[model samples]
Target: MSTSLKIYDTTLRDGTQGEGISFSVTDKLLIAQKLDQFGVDYIEGGFPGSNPRDISFFAEAKKLKLTHAKLAAFGATRRAGVKPEEDAQLRTLIESEMPVLTIVGKTWLMHVHEILRTTPEENLAMIEDSVRYLVAQGREVIYDAEHFFDGYLDNSDYALRTLEAAARGGASNLTLCETNGGKLVPEVHKIAAAAVARFGRDKVGVHCHNDSGLGVAVTLAGVDAGASLVQGTMNGYGERVGNANLVTLLPNLFLKMGRTANCAKNLKELRDLSLFFDELANLRPNPKAPFVGQSAFAHKGGLHANAAQKVARSYEHIDPALVGNRTRVLVSDMAGRTSLTLKARELGIELDERLPAMKGLIDELKEREFRGYEYEAADASFRLLIAKWLGQQKTFFDVENYRVIIERHNNQIWSEATVKLTVNGEAMHTVAEASGPVGALDKALRLALAKAYPQLQTMSLRDYKVRILESNQGAGSRTRVLIESGNGKKIWGTVGVSDNIIDASWEALRDSVEYMLMQS
Candidate 1:
């Protein structure tokens, strides 16, 4: 039978230590519920004594009815000479009323001597005293031997004694922490194996960081070395270079390593879980992240796309569906007929590569891209192009002409635009004013179509990006504009390029409206 591993998530505690990561009490509560739903074994709430946000989170979290994950509170072991019962931090931990308590204690003799200003034996006593007191209070104490790997290298005997002390004091698990995050995979495997032999497999856990860029590797190595518990943060968020990524580690443990975890059965929710964290963090998801990334299973090259079209395994490692992700065929200038065919199929469009129109479309795509059109980032534009080539594109409206004027008077500037278009063979002219030329144009255009297409009212421009194609040309440089629009339901991207910035913006804005109408 595969060894059942305990997945101890420190995302709420340690993950908040990462730069640019901050969560409100409600955010913490929501994430805890999500982790429980995802089937993680433990959720480490933050240090209650550190900040009111964490204290508030613990208070609110106690009311949350988490289904699977046991709520764990994180803190350091009682101070150098302080008794556990008298320690304010320890008292706060107990007041938080969490069932599982993880207390990090100094494992390195240098920390004991220099940092704690205490003797090696005194540090051992502190670890024992803290763990014993917590256990006596009916808490399942998990002792985090901070800097265990580095301390073990410094003085193996003293490090082994630290674990023995925690064990004697009733620590349910002895977690060997690679605090510096600089330990190699081999070193972690060897040290973790030795610790497991000394303290039994079920009693030893591993916590690693990613300073060496091997947090995931070393974590897997620890598991390989018979550690039964794994501790890390989701999305690799932590202090410094971050902790071993449970987002990356969970799949490795359950799928690649054939290990059983409480979360193993909910493996299909992996991508959603990763995305959920990114969304809450307000950080753009890493497109290149393994397993759950947008580009993880995206095929771009012609040959690669062709092979993937014939046999998915030719380009993909495992079935993306296993992790709730799907393969994407990116359409680019380098795309072959097979690539276009696959891309078309992905978009729910029927395009037979053997058709003569396929060759023309490919040639046109290359020519357009050579002229600074990027289809990959503009899916809506690409779909429109396919429709035009296939003679299936609808002509909802036709623009006769558009004019934009900017005026600066009395230190105030304003832009006005006039648009003339025909909707269903009826001439329509509209004029509007805004703060910028693009904004003016958008207002005028929408005014012209408001009555004809009320659906465009909910659709508004969400984002606009402009890139100069040729910097050397300076004032005469060709500009590419990308616009993202949302109709309160789905979002789509469109692109346009021209020598004039206004022209480029107009092209993108027009395409955005056309794409929305086409869909409607």
Candidate 2:
């Protein structure tokens, strides 16, 4: 029977090392579970002995029954002249009781001589001794030859000797690392082919980094050259450019290359997984990442949208459903009638080609987008604009007048806001004081809306972003405020621009409430 390629993920170990990325113990476990659902063969948790959070992750992860993947602990090989049994880090790896352990060892002669400050003979001994000790302790060891490709190119004999040490030491597998990740495809093919020839295909693995932007290509070369195990990170997280993104690489290999049996995962889930990590990290998802990014299947141009509407494959490289991503027909100034018709159908609104309202709405959308009001990002507000254009939106309430009073006390600013509103044919007035003008206005607006729509009491603003359209003019400059509000079930965003920041905030706040009320 043919075997599938083994996917080893190091997102928790290597991904967390990425600049500006730090995962709590709980975050690691959540990501681990997501990888398991992605059909990974192994999940490499961080080095158990290096940090308390990682140690806690290992302890907690082992208690959960993972369905598809085995959790692995990562660490360096034992120190020179020290037995693995006596090494505290190695002992910690064993205590984690994970089914697999990966220990990296020196392969490049330069590293052996300079970084390790040891003779080649001692480096080989370290490799052999470390693997043997781990195997003796009943742990399955994968010996990673750091910088193996560069080492193989510089000194073929020494590189082969390092592998021989691991083979003789009872290592279950030996992985070649492109540690600097500067290698090209031809070089990776050459080295991986030679390693497979020397070590036998079953005993070899590939660990690639993305510094040169060729990590995925190099990994594919290694696989083609008969490396059975591919090690990388989810979303390509790591130091510098990052490791090979297995999320993208896997689908490419499975669907495009036909190398492995379909893992039965909904490819669209990859998007959710990527966004889940971004949310956990409090970072925005990349809009252009392959397979799962926001723009992966988004079409904006008229010709492209028209072509995609007729034959999606003409514009899309692959079916979006293959990776759990949906094609988004973005309506912009460039969008044509085909794009608008498709979007209307998606929104469950009938498309009437001769309707002047439809054409007017498209024109209005283009005009607003020209001023930096991005309907793509402010989707809820865009929906309201669409509904109003169609004469289908209901007016929840009307604002008669509103005023904000700013007072200076002890060199500090205070704001008192008052609003007069008509709700369901009745007029009501309310006043609220807050730390700032916008805060006070928002407080007063919410209080007034709550009287009519009781559900407004549960809503909260989750994120607020402000951008200065032109900053050269300083405090008097016109700025844009983008507000994202959520009520647990749904999220809506709106944008407002003005010279007065308070007015911009009020506009955004009013649009947010109006969008929510329209949804209700």
Pick the lDDT winner: 1
> Which of the numbered candidates is closest to the native, going by highest TM-score?
1
lDDT of each: 0.92, 0.85
Q: Which ten residues in a row have the lowest lDDT in candidate 1?
A: 351-360
**Model 1 Cα displacement at 275 (Å)?**
1.6
The deviation in Å at residue 77 for candidate 2 is: 2.2
Q: Candidate 1: where are CA atoms >4 Å away? A: 406-414
lDDT of 1: 0.92
Give the TM-score (vs. native) of candidate 2. 0.93
Model 2: per-residue lDDT, tens digit, 1-520? 2446778888898888899889998888888887787677888998886878987998898887889888889888778777767888888888999988898999899998889888899889888888888888787888889999989988999999999999999998889999999999999999999999998989999999999999899999998898989998878889999999987887788777767733435455777877887888778888999988888999888789889989999999999988888888777788767777776666666677677887788888788767656656676776777788878888888899999999999998899999999999988798999887777888898898786798887788888888887688899888788889999898878888788777777888889999888777
Q: Candidate 1: deviation at residue 8, Å?
A: 1.1
TM per candidate: 0.96, 0.93
